[model samples]
Target: MAESRPNTEVDLNSWLPITASRKAKWWYSAFHCVTAMVGAGVLGLPLVLARLGWIPGIVAIAVAWLVTWYTVWLLIQLHESESGKRFDRFTELGQHAFGEYLGFWMVMPQQLIVQVGSDIVYMVTGGKSLQKSLALITPQADFRKTYYILMFAAIQLVLSQSPNFNSLKIVSLLAAVMSISYSFIATGASLWKGFGEHHVVHYGFRSTSTVKIVFDIFSSLGVLAFAFAGHSVALEIQATIPSSLGNPSKKPMAKGVTVAYLIVALCYFPVAISGFWAFGNLVEDDVLLSLEHPNWLISAANFMVFIHVIGSYQVFGMPIFDKIESTLVTKWHCTPGRPLRLVARSAYVVFTAFMAILLPFFGGLLGFFGGLAFASTSYIMPCAVWLKTQKPKPWSFHWILCWISMLIGITIMTLAPIGGAHEIIVSWKSYKLFQ
Candidate 1:
């Protein structure tokens, strides 16, 4: 008998089939990846770069990029080995690669900590933007708490019922365009206004050394990593793409991941640099505030922030929802129907809303979440999985190097929040106003 050829058509109805074309896949993957990048870091980068200077900031970003790449590669390798698919839920990959028990525990903290934390950060940022925008119009109105509640409900409604992934592609594309457009506008406005003319000279590893600067830069590394923390989304994107691009190989998926990360870094770096250069020492928690432009630009950026939060909610919420549903159906024998999913998702929304209300100070929450929640998901868990699964294959020098870097990344993420913990506590006390 003649050898049979493999079927190239990716079944869209199947849960794990690669169904999108290469070009479409790349674009979609880039959208999610960049959205994750711009979520928290776009606002935080200016302060870090102002203190650390471009050199250290760039170095930290480079380290973050490396960590992101390795983490994605590990995920792809594990996914290929077990499910013959790309990673979607952390638990799915975990179960296949490790086993049920280990995967359950491994994914449990990630669902509670990283996923919920990301949602809280999104809601908090949205609340801050709402407050700022409202203050401009109805100066006397205290709408922060109301805005938070509304946003939480709105996001929950959208996420409770699953959305077409293609809609996400559109949202992601618009976000990327808005991010780039505002960045260019900000850069142009700063240049036209001569924002960098009165630049303050701050010494880093070169000039007069201060403990504060060193700590800030080190802490900023953690922040940067958190900013670049969604490489797994790239894997999901790849899984969504048609596997005919490399049906029997993982190279196409790897390429998609690499391209996605690079595009995100490109879009992010300019915004960070320009925002810092414009605001210098007086930079606010959100960099959009620093743009010296017409009211329209600021409004557009604010709206973009809202859209970005919606996208973030989807990316963060989906995996968490999937994990919760899986556990209920498989372990507890609860039916995973639409009603049950809604209930699970509603519970998450309520919980995240409570956190968002309790932690209204955007900057403090960003740092704390970056150090604790984002750190574990982006750095710690991936590293742990890589270490566990890639064993028996002798550890090469490169592997050792990656392990060392992972440790450093984890340490920075763990300890960086100490600098801001007191402020977060203080803000919690004052959060009642927002509540």
Candidate 2:
């Protein structure tokens, strides 16, 4: 007779342990995926739409959602194939697909870079919200940098000291609540004020050419693809749940991820569409800026933004620290005591602080991150791994579609220029002078 496989049952506790039921796992996966999608992506949509136009913007968002779903499917498939373990580390899947050495070198740095880039974006946005809030009390004070550092440090401390995954679940729940409340408040206020009536002027779409439309669609698609790229979190949760309760097959995890992404798209797309419709050409880089109106509404929005940012930092930071700890302790055989923990904490603080200082140079930062970092890791690398490792199933058409979407996403992101208003105005001036 074949030997029985070892049971992987874990004990549950309030302190640092990893026991979670199917219900807990579902909620955890849902919250993490939702939070990641909402962070910087929602805020950036209005500006993208204003430049690209309404039709292209809508198409981009829709296509991007499909791409995100497909990419996630590929990731989960890889996980299931290699380890036969649902919740293995992403790097392990890479290692199984590629060689161990190539996997370690490629996956580690890419994961770190993506996480760090995301944290920096959150820190900057959170700091901006705090600065705006403080300005209400001390109108002339400049606390942007100060608040950024403080928020970063606080997030680091919270993530580092958290006893277990349950705390993260609580944080995720709070984030969901804040996100729902903020979305409702912003939409309600916009409708009540007759937001469309105040639109000053409108600019016609710049390009009727097929090439221009394609380019616009591609650019917007990059943002949308990233908005739904956190399905790995769901995979992790699925791994922890009892296989007997649900199908041992990975279909539930994939289905859950699909539902979560659809929910996010529903919440985010309407807000994005409405913001662009109301503000037209005057839409700011951050849509939250466009939502600023009525003193009470502004305050409420600011507070919501602040909480959402904090929640984002906590969620992202925890996973990052967990990965770092695992690599150092298990892979490197380093003792993971107070000293190592402190070192990790200090590193996080310093990195976030530097990024906060560099936020004023947003164009350069976003360019480096979106073009080189995010595209390579989130879009290109995941697809490459899946294509190399997994056996094709009957429904493999979905996989082919995902790969194509990712290629389109990468091309679009690479071509989209970095600078915002200043760049646009300068380019227009140069063209006028030449004309």
Candidate 3:
């Protein structure tokens, strides 16, 4: 199943985004994973937990962590599945697993959706967090979230032009730090609120109706699924690591991912449990929104969220940029240079910002996009490719595990989006665009 690469006078790999650099260390993958996984979605965990109650919510988060960790490892191994060839892109690996045409079609669409959808969500998260931070600082100063969204997009317009993954080192590093910082602040603040005498927290299901509760639980899974999303960029991240027969990229990649998952554990559990314990069913869709007291600290946390998502947007958007620019050069015969990068990247930023301005429903967007594509690319697609490529014995451990993971992912894929769409529709009834 090893597809031979064509001989070319010019090495196009140097021009492609993912393969442009090979000097990355194991730590790069660690923070990139953290920056990718612990994003705007973490802010929503309290709400997710609130919806599902204590036991189910905690169980859901734990299970998602284990499942995604396993699936991501499968993808990392599959990165160099073929001898002397590295599948830098998810579609490339998909092509290796299935065939050229079918794999491209299957993995590309889902991966694109995950990338573009994530950028859109980051736009909304960045803008809303900015707006909230400013509101806290200057309580009397009122402005539309659209304005902040534009402001946020302006920063991306510049950052998005970065030539390759290596260029994002500082941005990604800061984002990873901010993620940890705000998670700590959020968890500590929640504990503070929970212990305050004036506040009474009731731990119970947010919804009373069985039907509503069921849908909310499904939607909650999507939110949690959204929280654990870093799989889309796993191979691309690995591509940056220098690899050879004696020292495969997976060694360092696995080391990085292990540390990254530990970071995920630290950030996710405390924030989710403490926030839910602090606010119970009354938690806002974003935990930061729920913690309004101590204006300075909360404002700082929001600002940190703003800064963090700025990097998160690019992390997700880079692959999409690579896809678009590569296609333009290879298929359309466009020159690969600064002019192309400027035009392609700028258009993408504008597009995501425009969509974000139109639909800023953060929770609904997470659920919809998470289930619609995140679950596929982050959860299901890896396992699917594993089963196809490895062809494990029927009912054997690996085979059973892959099937079980797929079933869980399929359940999320099918149900979460329905709940998300429903949430969007509910929000849309009273919503207007660009206000």
List, residue by residue over 45-116, the lDDT tens digit for candidate 3.
989889988888889999999999999999999999657588999999999988999999999989888889
Model 1 vs. true fold: TM: 0.80
Clashes of each: 1, 0, 0
TM-scores for all candidates: the values are 0.80, 0.79, 0.97
- Writing each residue's lDDT as its tens digit, candidate 2 over 1-435 gives 222222222321111123233344555666766776675666667656766678877777776676666677667555565334553556666687788999877776766665676677677667666666556545677644555556655766656566334566777677766776676666565565444465564644434667655544444444554454464343444444445423553565566667667777766777677767666656665666666566567666766777786777666665566666555655675554556656875688567856565443332334344444555555666677776765456348756765686676567456643332233343345342211
> Model 2 scores what on Cα lDDT?
0.59
Q: How does each model score on lDDT? A: 0.61, 0.59, 0.90
- Judging by lDDT against the true structure, name the best candidate: 3
Against the hidden true structure, what lDDT does model 3 obtain? 0.90
Between candidates 2 and 3, the one scoring higher on lDDT is 3
Q: In model 1, where do residues sit more than 4 Å from their true spots? A: 1-24, 82-88, 95-99, 133-142, 145-149, 163-167, 192-219, 232-239, 242-249, 392-397, 429-431
Model 1 pairs in collision: 20-242
TM-score of 3: 0.97
